[model samples]
Target: MTQALPSLKDHCRTTVAELIRICQDRAVRSALRPLLAGIPDMQIRAMRYLPRNAPVNQDLLYLIAGLVAEYPCSLPEPNNVMSFGASLYKLSQHPDIKATGIERRLESLLQLELDSLMQPLHSLVVQFSSTQSSKTSIVIDYATLLYHLRCWDDSRKWVQLTWARDFWCPKEDGKEQNSDETLDIVKS
Candidate 1:
């Protein structure tokens, strides 16, 4: 009998946790500085620690690591609650975020193709961080994002559809829809 390979999601979760741990040390955190520049450079230092077997390519992983590092505050893996799309939705709904402004940004995000996703996505995440109230820290589910980036080329385009659903779907009973359920719906 052969052993099952680790799922990409699991790999991503471990990778993210390790990055956060390594960043806890000031020197190690400083090494990730290449990721902070407006445009990502191929020489990002954190690439050494990220798993090479991830479904997403090294460049995408580096971009994700940069985004995650932006939030130096506590990084807790929530129960599939705060995905990139869901977090954007929450940010769009924040009283401080003007509806027209956020709506335009969300539109641009939803329209991106895989080749064009990185920069715009980075900008949107930075926008979310800046526009959000100080009382609440930024939250983005990097593990799921890794999986989505890998699946960006799916014929059904489920990843983009899921993000659109999360952003545009009407809230039911003042509650956000479960992100997994939203994805399943997009898949079907």
Candidate 2:
């Protein structure tokens, strides 16, 4: 009989921890200082304590990319959004990971998880379009995420939807209050 391997979450935790340890050397820090200078110290500390069994998300992916980018070791490709997406696409094509068994592809699982997270925002957009409430903030937040993710088409769709319904304006004391900071951000 063969022993079962650890879960993907466990594997990811171990891999990240090992990578962090490798980058802890003085020489490595000096080299990485320029690139990592913009990242907060709190976030760096939090990386050390990432829960081993927790589900992955975009934030975790960003942190992992940041850490991987700073490593001096050679990788098949640079640690950037394109390379990350390519790696995920490659993983999605694997036979075992693609098999409809107990274990699914990591990319597929992550995509499903992300879609679930976005569902609430989609619902909020639909509801606010009809009701014109303060919940328009959710649509703004969703648009911002899309912008950062480089989904320009979807981001524009949300911005257009919000503008079409004039949801950016809030009625205050019988006056149309139109001081939405997010509107400025989304427009640019």
Highest TM-score: give the candidate number.
Answer: 1
Candidate 1 C-alpha lDDT tens digits along 1-188? 99998876677777777667766777665556456453444344456755556556766767676666655444444453444666677777677777677677768876777777767777777776685466765566676676778778888878776666667784542223555666676667
Q: Quote model 2's TM-score.
A: 0.23
lDDT per model vs. reference: 0.65, 0.34
lDDT of 1: 0.65
Report model 1's TM-score to 2 decimal places.
Answer: 0.78
What C-alpha RMSD separates each model from the true structure? Answer: 3.4, 21.2
| Candidate 2 CA-lDDT value | 0.34
In order of appearance, the predictions have TM-scores of 0.78, 0.23
Off by over 4 Å in 2: 1-62, 65-83, 99-188
Winner by lDDT: 1
lDDT of candidate 2 at residue 82, scale 0 to 100: 18
Per-residue alpha-carbon lDDT of candidate 2 for residues 49-144, written as tens digits (9 for 90 to 100): 343443345354333434333332222211111122222233223443332321233223233333343333232223323332333111122112
Q: After superposition, how far is residue 48 of candidate 1 from its true place, in Å?
A: 3.8
